[model samples]
Target: MKNIIIFGLFFLMVSCKSNPVTKLDNKTEVGLKGNWELTSVSYPNSSYIKINSFGIADSQCFETSSWRFISNNNQGEMALRKAGCPTFSSDITWYVNQEGNLVLKFVGADVKAKTVKEGYVLKVANLTENAFQLFDTVDVAGKTITLVYQFNRIK
Candidate 1:
């Protein structure tokens, strides 16, 4: 009985698997620490289709939007300023997840981030010193489309 128990313990220990390690990239966040402007939003067949990004106003509303990303505390703010568009601004808490995705939570309404139930996740791509792109995939008419958000450094 002792021999059987010892073998069982060994087998159990050998079969146990540890959690996978997360590949979080801090370099991407470092590169994003600055002021930027949302230059454009585009997708396939965008001439005919309109998309309201971030569940906010029309895609055009985000044009010329100012964004400030503070790398120290992972805090930021975004404001939209366009004629005939809904006014919007928010304090944002953001981080790059293990998969190199940008995770964003809006906490501007004097609400704690922990209490915010919804957030936005976007794929970071084409990162450069002066520009980058955020890709968002959405389903329209039973088809998947990639939406691109272009950012340009304000220098």
Candidate 2:
């Protein structure tokens, strides 16, 4: 009888164990839902500049730009606001790829070619309720540049 009781207790504990992968996926999904504002842009090779350090015009436009991620449908939108330029908004689909990379697909038809470009895959450095950081590398003029974007959740 004691052995049977011990086995029963062990079975209950085992049945209650949650899968780690499922837990992480849920946490990441929840953490990403919100309005995120670009706070800073970092370039390791070049001089790092804060969003506020940009020129008055650029600062105003950049400060007003933000990214909004919707939790219900996994869709996102990027809003760019500039004083002289017309307000630009793009439809984007976001998802965590199989390799855990954050992928942003821009939805639009190219004017000349009538082709849709591929999405941008960014490595997620950190993601939390209050902050998110993404890292990516770009090659420009034969020089490799590491781009880091820091965002803060809007209250």
Candidate 3:
């Protein structure tokens, strides 16, 4: 009876150990749960103009933007800080699709916010504990433009 009890306890302990793949997935999810600030935006296929957050002149709204992803709830918020500009805050539903694409669905009442209504699906070029990179391609004026957005986790 004593030997059987010891074996049972040992089996339970081993069974409770988390799978390595699950642990790694959890770590990646945790890494994405935080506030992130847009650091840079680049148009690689076109003019190759790389603009830093501070150097954004055309659109002040995007110059001071931040995103917060809530891993537990699978929700997010996009805050645009455009001083003296129309304030805009977007409640976003985010998820990783089966193909590993990062998808963002915007929920709001603003009719003018049509750009995000259909949802934005971006390729996750890179992701780490402190940095994230997203890539997408859009057609404008019959030209294909590749946009790369780089973000840094906010402390």
| Tens digits of per-residue lDDT for model 3, 11-128 | 9999999875412234445567889987766675334443322122333345457889888877788876757745667777776654556777766765333465477777775788
Task: State each model's CA lDDT, in order.
Answer: 0.90, 0.66, 0.67
Per residue, candidate 1 scores C-alpha lDDT tens digits across 41-123 of 89999888888788888887898999999987889999999888989999999988768799988886878999988999999
Error of 2 at 37 (Å): 0.4
In order of listing, the candidates' clash counts read: 0, 0, 0
As for candidate 1, its clashing pairs are: none
List the candidates' TM-scores in order. Answer: 0.83, 0.63, 0.63
As a whole number from 0 to 100, the lDDT of residue 28 in candidate 3 is 47
Better of 2 and 3 by lDDT: 3
Ranked by lDDT, the better of candidates 1 and 2 is: 1
Q: Which candidate has the highest lDDT of all?
A: 1
Show the lowest summed lDDT stretch of 10 residues, model 3: 51-60
Which whole-number lDDT from 0 to 100 does residue 69 have in model 2?
Answer: 83
Question: Residue 112: error of model 2 in Å?
Answer: 18
Quote the lDDT for 155 in model 1. 99
Q: Candidate 2 — what's its lDDT?
A: 0.66
